[model samples]
Target: MTTTIRSVETFRLRVPRDNGAPTERFRAAPRVRSIYPTADELLLVRIATDDHVGWGEALAPASPEAPGALIDEVFAPFLVGVDIAAGARPLTRRLQQTGRERGHLSGIQADAIAAVDIALWDLFGQVTALPVKTLLGGANVDAVPVYMSEVNGASAHAKAATAALLYERGMERFKVHLVGPPEIALAEYDVVRSEVGTSRLALDAHWVHGAGDARRLARGLDERGAWFLEAPLAPEDVDGHVRLAAYSGTSIAIGEAMRHRFEFAQWAGAGAMAIAQPDLGRTGITEAISIATIMGAHHIPLAPHHSMASGIAYAAALHVSAAVDDLLAVEWGPRIAERSDSFLDVAFLEPIGTSGAWIEGGVVAVPAGAGLGIHVDEEAVRRLAAG
Candidate 1:
């Protein structure tokens, strides 16, 4: 009995705005211009075998210039009519291997592969009647710690206020997204650190700075007491990161934009990153676990990244975080945390501690249920899918 990939449905979920107001934090006031009109464009793939249905979401940018189109037009066609249970790993390997020659690491192809990979895992879990963490080697904890990710809003003051609010809500770890010059980022970091008060303040430079600039900014941040500096240089700048990590007391965190476990292996082997932040959406559970294992071998902590695509991605991250031995707290976007309940009809999973620190006294837990252990609100997915 083979589990067949019956069909693939690709659709866009535009979180509608009321009266042109920001529908969510990603779209809220003093718009950053770069992150607005946020939409949850996903490719929902349904695989069936023996009365079992497995759902997967491929989250892509709303813009045509981006990679979502590749997932819809290119990847979906390859996945149709295949047996998911038996063929998923082979298909993923083939897709990745084929993509390597074409230099297709990021974009629609990656997103599409990720969607199918995740769906296959979900299907596998459902078929086995086991949660993903159990499949990965059982749960290590009950819930994973979460850090509040800052929105790229217009005003620094408003963003700082938002950070403070999250801190008040039991978030100990906070990260401010850096989109501009080092000085501008430094100032914003200062505001948030002052607001949150020197606990676990991290800055994600988003690969916007060069080595020299990163060094200068990192030195300044070290003085101000930042826990880590993330993606200060471009993803390809492994040497730059290694140098920055060596020079600054701030731990260098990378790997979100990077795909594949081997990429993380190289980074970890080279001591390029002190923290390995892999997005399960991009790497999938299999590859993410591989990355985490590699990072664990190097004694590096795995901190998965989360965003506002669906609960699937978040659940996937949680499962992975629970299984990894050297797991650090995962990144949780407050934007998603605030609106996840409204978007999806499920209990707010777990309270990421106040002030952005997820691991209280150095311990975190994973959510327990069946499959990913998250109850997906099919109604919400349907409503967003309808729109």
Candidate 2:
């Protein structure tokens, strides 16, 4: 049984959640509305050998077809027939170098590389009979603590109801995604706080604020004992983040837009954020670990962000989250699992415990198997791709 890349495939899927219901917060704050799509879109990659198959996904919230095409036209040719004996990291470096001449180490090109890198790691794990965590230097925690991301509803009372329901389901921490004036955000926060009755709330400003506005919001969050304030300023404003973090009592969180270690190194060096949130679907397993190392060196805790990506991305995040020692909490979208798990044969990650007896903690155990620890429905993926 020779171990070599036998086939490489890509799927672009767009699954609408709640019939593509419009996000109310985005409507209220149109400045950042374009940052997120109305539906969940994904770019999934499959790499197979003689006997085993591996799955990977990239964080393609919009225009996923671009990266899907990149995988087929650019990355697939280079990956097919390659030997998997040396494992994923060496191959990942080589693949990154292939695009270095084209200056394709960031953005959509890096995203395509991310999918291939993750699939290769999955293949490597199965071939070596080890979990991805072990390949990344073993797990430091038994389970990764998670914070429920976004308190959603139509109105303030509805938002409170949503928060209460999640609280009953064992979600102890939450982040409010509000992008506008600080007063509007604080009023919503107060509504949610009344329902959850906990000081473990966080906020995502959607990168819409200037330093002055971010400082005002941070003051409100600090008074409420927020777990963190995420993306307070523009993604490129490292200096602004450093300034805001310097004075804000609330921990500042950043890093979902970044794809490589170099960007993370700059932010880490500048002390731009109190928490580092590298998304595995964007950074891939190799670079996400590298970014984590950079964050660790600066004494910043890793909190890994999650949004509309599929279950493969979620599993990858869990593996990397477990491996990092200075972990805070992985961001968990409350209703994201419904669409994220739609195409999977078996759920790699799911809400633990049953209704009425839900576990009273917000921790997720790392999947317990080789090659990302989940099964992908290839037929379903093919059908979706064909459509």
Model 1 — which ten-residue stretch has the worst lDDT?
25-34
lDDT of each: 0.68, 0.83
| C-alpha RMSD in Å of predicted model 1 compared with the true structure | 4.2
TM-scores for every predicted model:
0.83, 0.94
In TM-score terms, candidate 2 sits at 0.94
Per-residue alpha-carbon lDDT of candidate 2 for residues 1-387, written as tens digits (9 for 90 to 100): 779999999888877667546653222337783555666778999999998888999998877888889889978898899999889998888878877866566988888888888898888889988889998889987577888776777776787788788788778888878876888888888888899876388888889888888999999989888888999999999999999999999999999999999998998898888899888888899999899888889999999988878778888999999998788888886455676556784344555665543364577778878868777778888887777
lDDT of candidate 2 at residue 287, scale 0 to 100: 93
lDDT of 2 at 149: 79
User: Which regions of candidate 2 are displaced past 4 Å?
Assistant: 20-29, 33-35, 354-360
Please give me the total number of clashing residue pairs in predicted model 1: 20
**Each candidate's clash count:** 20, 0
Best by lDDT: 2
Candidate 2, residue 144: lDDT: 79
